[model samples]
Target chain A: MIERNGLQSGSQDPAPEGALLPVVQVGRPADVPRGRADAARNRARVLDAAQALFAERGVQAVTMDDVARAAGVGKGTLYRGFGDRAGLAMALLDDRARAFQAAVLDGPAPLGPGAPADDRLVAFVLAYFRFQADHLELVLESEAGRGPGARLAKGSYRFWRQHVAWLLQEAGAPHAGTRAEVLLGALAADQVRHWLVVVGRPADAVAAELAAVARSLLR
Target chain B: MIERNGLQSGSQDPAPEGALLPVVQVGRPADVPRGRADAARNRARVLDAAQALFAERGVQAVTMDDVARAAGVGKGTLYRGFGDRAGLAMALLDDRARAFQAAVLDGPAPLGPGAPADDRLVAFVLAYFRFQADHLELVLESEAGRGPGARLAKGSYRFWRQHVAWLLQEAGAPHAGTRAEVLLGALAADQVRHWLVVVGRPADAVAAELAAVARSLLR
Candidate 1:
C-alpha cells in the first residue's frame, strides 16, 4: 500500500512534469523495487521505530544503534537502508511529505479539490504549519548546509509554489507567480520553526497571521 | 555632495530623516579621534585599493597580500585595520550598504521620501536590485554561515523591513508587517543572486513583475 506513493493520485490533472522527488532530494518517494515485500516491511518497521525514538528523545540525542535495536533489525540493515541519521530524517520526511501531497491532491476538501480557492489557500497554510511543527527538529537538522534560497529548488517546494500559483490565477490575481513565491516565503521551514519554537508563539497565532496575509493578498 | 542622492530636479521638499551614509557603519566615518590624519589617509587608501581589487578579481580570488601591495600599505596595517580577507570583504560591503541605505532613506523623491507610497515601493524594488547587482559577489561571501534566514535578524534587515512596513501602512495596506516581509523576500541576497544569475531573468523584468505584484496588492 505504501508503495502507491510512487503512483499518481486519482486526479485527472497530472502532477507537474518531471517532478518526482530526485533520489538526492530529501523525501524522494519510496521507489523500492517491486516484489521486495520483506525489504519494504523492514523499511517501514525501521521508520516507525526511528520516528518514535527520535520524537521521544529528539533528533540530535537519538543514535542509529538505538533505532536499529528498537526496530529489531540488524545494524547492517539500518545502515544499508538509511545510510546515516540525516538520511534517516530525510526518509521519514519523505513518507509524511508523500502522504501530504496525495491528500491535498486528491484526499478531500477544503484541502482537496472541492473548496473555493481562497479556502484551499488558507487550509494549505494551516496544514503546512502543522506538518512543520511535527517535524521541526528533523527539518532544521536535515536542511543544514543547504543555503536559504536553495530550498526553492526542491521538488516539494516547487509543488507548493505551483499549487499556490494555480489558486492565485484561479482568482484572477495579477502576477500570480511572483505573488505565489512571496506568499510561500511566509511558510519557509526555518522561519516557521523559529516563530513557533524559538519565539514560543502558539501555532494558532501564526496560522491566523498567515490566513490574514492570504486574505489581504487574495482580496 | 552626498545630499545630492536625495534632491530631485522638481522636488522643492528635501528628503526625510537624517539619512546620510553613517561613518561608523562602513568605516566609522573617520573615527580619526583628532590628530590622526595619517592613519585616516592610510585607511582610505587601503579601502580604495580593496574596492578596486575585489571588483576586478571577485572576492574569493583576491588575497590579503594583493590588497596590501595594491594599497602601498604594510601587511601589518592591512591585518590590523581589517583583520583578514573576510574582514576586508565585510568592510567593503559595509561601505556600499551604508551608501545605499542613505540614498533610500533621505536622498530624493521616489526612493528618498517625497514620492507617493506606491512609487516609493516600486522605486525601492528597482534600486535594491541594482544594489544587489553592484555587490553580488561581496554579499554572497560576507553573508556566508549566516543562514539565509539568519540575515533577517540583522540590523540592516530590520531597517529595511521597518521602512517597507511604514510605507505599506501609509498606503492603508492590511497586514503591513507580513506583506512587507514577503515583499522583502524577493530581495534576499541568496534568492536575488539565484534569480538573476541562475534563472538568468533580467533584473528589469523581475522588477517589473514585482512592481505589478505590489500594484495589485496595494490596490
Candidate 2:
C-alpha cells in the first residue's frame, strides 16, 4: 500500500488482499503423484494466465477473479485449485524451489557438491542470480505478505547455512553458526531484489562480485 | 490511504498521503536567524509536537493540522518552516544521519578510519546495527521513497565498499570493486529493515554475526 511521494493524485490503498496458501511446509508430503491430471492441467493454465497478468499489470494490481477469467476458468475452480492468491504464488515457487535445491544438491560439481566450498559458494551465488534473472517476477511473488519464502525452509536455508558453517569450520574460524547466519542473511532474496530490480545493477556482475566477496570471507 | 485488505478499499494509494514532504532543502535564510525568540520557540514546539504525534500515530496518520495544533503554532507557520510532511521527515533525518556517519567515519578505531580494513569492515557493520538499535523507526522512515534521509551524501556507500574492496586487494585479490558492491548491497539498509522488522531477527545478534562474516570474508 506504500505510495510514491510524488503520486498524490494517483494515491490509493491496495486491494482487499488476503493470504491464501501456507508458504512453509508444515509437514512433508509423500512422494506419491496424488494430484489428478485435470487438476494439474488447470493449475498450469491458471499459472500461465497469472504469470502473463502479473507481467502486464504487476502482482499488486491483479486479482484472483482476473486470473480465473484470464485462464478461462470459473472463479470457484481457481479458488479450489490454489486456495487464494498467496497459495497460487506459493505453488509457483514449489517447482522452482525444488529445482534450485536439486541443483545445489545434485546437479553438478561446483554448484552441487564435489568442488571446494569456496568454489561451490561462488557457483551457488552465480546460479542464484541466474535463477533470479530468469524468474524475477515469480520469485518476488512468493515474497508477498512476509509469507513462506520469507522464512527458512527447513531443508533449504538450513542446508546452505550448514554448508557455509562447515566451510568456515574447515577454514578454522570461530562462530561458524553465526557466520553462516550472517552469510545467508546477506545473500537473502530481498538483497537480490533490491540489487537486480531497484538498483538496476547487472546480474552477472553482481554474481561475480558476490562470489568474490564470499571468497574473501573464507580466504 | 492504503486501508486494511478486508475492505474493498477504493484504491487508496497510501503512497502520497503519508509522505507529503517535498524533496527540497529547507529553511535557510541569507540573514541572521529571521525568526524572533518566540518564532524559535514555536519552531522547537512544532518539532517536538511532530515527533510526539508521529510516535503516537504513525507518520501516515498525523496531518499538518494535527502537527500545527499540537505545536501551538499556525498551520501557515508550520508550512513555511517544513514545506510538507516529507520535508519534515527529511529534517528529522539530518541529525540522526550525521551521528550515524560520524559513528562510522570518526568514532572509534575499529569502526573509524584507522584500523585494518578487515577490522574496520567489521566495525562499520556493527556500527550500522548500533545505529539501527537506537533509531530503528527513523531508519525505516528514511528508507522509503523520497523520505528525508534518502539522498545520502555522495559516495556514502563508496566509503564502506572501497574499504572492503581494499581489504580484498590487500589480501592479494586485486579486482575488488564489484565485489565490494555486492558485499555492501547484501548488508545495506533495505536488507537490514527486512531482517530487523519483518523477519524479527535480533539486531544485536545479527550485527555480531555480520561482523563475524566480515572478518571471515577478510581474514
Candidate 3:
C-alpha cells in the first residue's frame, strides 16, 4: 500500500489512500472471511445507492438517512463507512476518478495509449468534459469552501496536469505546462455547472466546443 | 444614477454602482462644497494608501489600521467608509476595475478599439493577466467563500465576457460564447494565483502564452 500523505489527510475513505493508484485489497485473499466479504458488498451497495439517489434527486436533497434507506444498510453502518455527506461525496468522486484514470492509463487508444498526442488530447478533453458534466454537483460539493487552489492539491488534478503536459510535449507544443493548466482550468467543476445549469447549454455542444478548442491549441 | 441591482447588493463601495460605467459624481457641481470635496479627496487618499500598503506588504499582512494611518485618516473614518478589510478590498478592486474597463473602452489601439479582433483579444488577455498579477491577493480575499460561481455574477466579469464574445464573433470563431467563457476561465483569479505563486512562473511568460493561445483560437 502506498503511504498516505498529508495532502489527503482530510479524506475519510476507508479504501486505500493513493488517488491514482488502483484500490488494492491489501490483506484480503481469494478465500476471504464471510464478514469482510459482506462488508465489501455492503460498501458497493451503499455507493451504488448513493450514486443513484444523488443522480435522481441531487446531492443536496439526499441525506445520510436517505442514502442508508436506499442502500438497505443502517444509519450506523453508513456513518461508520463514510463520516458525513462531504466524506461520502469525496469517496464517490475518488471511486470514479480512479476508474477514469485506469481507462486513460490502460484502456483503448486516444484516451489511453498508442494514439497521436493531438488525438489523445482531444479525446481526453471530451472525456473529461463528460465526466464533469456527469458529476458536476458532486465535484462541486467535494470541492466547496476548500479555497480556490484546493483542486491543484488533488492527486487527480496533478495526474491530469502531468498527463496533459506530457501529451503537449510529445506533440511538440511550446509552453506545455501552462497550456495544460489552461486546458484543465476550462474543466473546473463550477465553470461546468455554470455552463450546463446557469447558461443552459447542451452538454454535447459544450463538450464538443471544448474538444475543438483543445485540438486547436495543439495546432 | 442607475438603479442599484440586487447583484451588487453585497458591494460596499460608496461610489456609484455600475461596474463598467465611469464613477459619476452625483449632485457634485463644478463648484463643489468644500466639505464634500474634502471627503472625495480623503476617499482617494484612502484607496491610494491601501493600494500601496497592499502592494508593499501583501493584502493579508496589511490591516485597516495601517491603511487609516497611511492615508492620514482616522480609524473611525476608515471603518465608517469601508465597513471592514473585505469592504476595503472590494472598494479597491472596484476602483481598479472601473479604470481598467475605461481603458478597454476608450484607450488606444490593441486593448481599446480600432484594432483587428485577434489583436484585440491578445491585448485583452495580456492586460487581464497583468491586472490579475498586480491584484491577486486582494481579489482572492474579496472573493473568498463567495462560492465557485460567484465570479460569474460580478458585473465586471459579465462585461468582460460580453466584450470577449463580441471579439470572438467578429473574428468568425465558432462557438464564440463558449470560447469566451473558456478564455476567461484561464484568467480566473485563483488559477492566476496558482500560476504566478504556486507554479512560480513569471507573469510575462504566462501572459504571453495565454495571449498566444487566445490568438490561436481566433484562427
Maximum-TM-score candidate: 3
* DockQ (model 2, Cα): 0.24
Which of the two candidates, 1 or 3, achieves a greater TM-score against the reference? Answer: 3
Kindly list the per-residue Cα lDDT of model 1 for residues A1-219, writing each as its tens digit: 344444421111122322334322334343435436676688879989998998799877888899999999998887666555545666667657767877788869998899988888888888887887778788655544343355566455677888889988886667777678777767776677757765577888787877777665675
- Clashes counted in candidate 1 amount to 6
DockQ of each: 0.32, 0.24, 0.52
Give lDDT tens digits, candidate 1, residues B1-219.
122221121011111211222322432433324434565566667778887888798776787789899999999877666544544555666546766787787779899889999888888888887887668887665544443245554445567878888888888777677677767776666667866887788888877887766665564
**Model 3: per-residue Cα lDDT over B1-219, one tens digit each:** 544332232232442322423333222233323336566677778989998998899887887789999999999878766655555777777657767877887889889999998888889999988988888888776555344576675555677888999999999888788889889989888888998898798888888899988977785
Residue A33 accuracy (lDDT) in model 2: 54
Using lDDT, give the best candidate's number: 3
Model 1 chain A, TM-score vs. native: 0.69
Tens-digit lDDT track for model 3 on A133-186?
888888876655344576675555777889999998898888788789889989
Clashes (backbone N, CA, C under 3 Å), per candidate, total 6, 18, 0
TM-score winner between candidates 1 and 2: 1
Which residue pairs of candidate 3 clash?
A: none
